[model samples]
Target: MAIRIKGYKWEFNLIESPEINAWCMPGGKVAVYTGILKITKDDAGLATVMGHEIAHAIAQHSAERASQMTVAQVGGGLAGAAVGNKSESTQAIVNQLYGIGAQGLYVLPNSRKQELEADKMGLSFMAMAGYNPQNAVGFWQRMAAASEGAQKPPVFLSTHPTDESRIAQNPRDLPEAMKYYKK
Candidate 1:
């Protein structure tokens, strides 16, 4: 399926967590938590989520983030009191910049440009696989419902919020996607 959709064959593994998560590692490796299967419901939803995951690989977002973090660390080291060695203040600034201050680590969020690019790419992949791109809406609706009232929404939803604009705007891709649908 990954090959059909993303032009890359994939290998799968199981993860023991209730995170409702999945990712496509750099080398066509795919790991999907059992927890997500409930909401995926059918092949179309699974393909939607998988396509999005594959987009991360295609766009090299993970590598881009690692590069940014490496540059930031290097810059901090050169700036003054050896932040690279061990400096609490420098680490704090880096953490905040990377959105990981709360965890005392470096975490990066995808830029809005990257997010939109992934959405378009994923939609194209699903369409290429003969999944109705409209099903992407229902997939996210289920995702949003699954996260209701949580202190923090799921990480996936945190990054891909189901705002009015995103929802209303997404279906517009259907005309483009339908051209690829076989059924």
Candidate 2:
């Protein structure tokens, strides 16, 4: 629960986008969209969204993802090298196919794991930041409702957990988050 955020030069900005979205890039750069403000009606709701995005930066999810991609690229190179004696077409095909398989087998699954990790970390962070973590549930529930009827890729092929899964996880993470909440 002790997260040291003092060293980074953090930048938080409200972007003038109509999309209900938020993101945190590496090195503590964060942006919250104006459209999401409708859902996040107050400070606690806003905290719920910001805490989750901040958790991604705090945990270095972007770095981790880049590392994973680099590894997958290296793996493809190795695979192509193993077929060095083959024709140029054969090597290209091997590398290309390997990239696809690696994305499904390695990259996307890790991305989903990061999302879940951020969800739990976000809860703890919001609580520690003096906002009740319980608000996260309502926030995510609203997100789910907001996205209802939107078509989505199947879970296995997606980079994030389904809304149902995220909503389900919020309550399970609350008890741990409450440990960080004071008053």
Candidate 3:
């Protein structure tokens, strides 16, 4: 696998939890809940999850998000500073609008964009690691089934893209990921 982990120390842990979830934190910390193992079913399936999470860390999604939030906060602070001399009600209104505008205009949209990017990169990484990227589709399918009865927010309000959307996008990503496969 040519996926570089040179600069950062990577750690992977399997947690004994019922939630079928996994994540990679910035700086290469990774956790996979045992419940997700059932859905993974095989090495390829596990690779899909690990690759996706690692891609997030590799892409520095958290750093991007933190920067974005910081910018939004600075904008809010500026706005509040400008309105410092105004009436209390005016200051309150400006702050409220800043919160809504910051989230709707940039944060939410960028979050969804990051998820798609991670999905693509993860697939490639999986293939490079000698796992068939095609197996990712089944992993996502099982994931969708696992959460079938759960409540999901509207796409606009959600941080992560829908599983169905991810599933749909997987095929488009596979050909590219296949290029990285050596065997």
Candidate 4:
């Protein structure tokens, strides 16, 4: 990890779910799920997952989402006023729409653009860290398969870039990452 990102390092911790996951916080805080070990299966694959999540942190997606949410809330308040509906039914509708908008703007997985950018940045980070870039494909495939048949909240998947789409694009960015691959 240090090799890939100058200030980053690995930390192990327990989480409640079986989902494979990883994330990096500002100032290089990192955590990787033991469950993800099953899917990653190798250093390179694990690096792919870690790199992508770390890329998200580096890109400050969380902050961007937060900002978006604030804006959405303000907009919703204004829109709600314009609708001039204060009844229970109207309030419920507004709440529902607000929920949907919030999901799309912040809680969602990320846009296609964000996903692609993460892939590109993550691959570079992984390569610089001396991991092979080709492993990204297997990682995404495992992620897609793992997500199958799992019950998910409706608004959740609506905002996220589908795992399948990401898997397809991962390889296309390999050429760029290959330039940085260690060997």
- Could you say which candidate leads in lDDT? 3
Query: Model 4: per-residue lDDT, tens digit, 124-165?
Result: 889999998888888888878888998755545564566777
TM-score of each: 0.69, 0.91, 0.91, 0.78
- Report the C-alpha lDDT of model 3 over 1-183, residue by residue, as the tens digit: 335446678999999999888998988999999999999999999999999999999888999999999999999999999999999999999999999888888899899889988889999999999998989999999999988999998787788889989999999989999999888
Steric overlap count per candidate: 0, 0, 0, 1
| Root-mean-square deviation of every model | 5.4, 2.0, 2.1, 4.1
lDDT of the structure predicted as candidate 4: 0.75
Model 3: residues with Cα > 4 Å off, grouped in runs: 1-5
- State the displacement of the C-alpha of residue 94, model 2, in Å, after optimal TM-score superposition: 2.4
Window of ten residues with lowest summed lDDT in model 1: 100-109
Query: Cα RMSD for candidate 2?
Result: 2.0
- lDDT on C-alpha atoms for all candidate structures: 0.68, 0.89, 0.92, 0.75
What TM-score would you give candidate 1 relative to the actual structure? 0.69
* Full-model lDDT, candidate 1: 0.68
Residue 38 lDDT in model 3?
97
- Tell me the tens digit of each residue's lDDT in model 1 across 97-132: 544431122332344345656666778789898888
On TM-score, the stronger of 2 and 3 is: 3
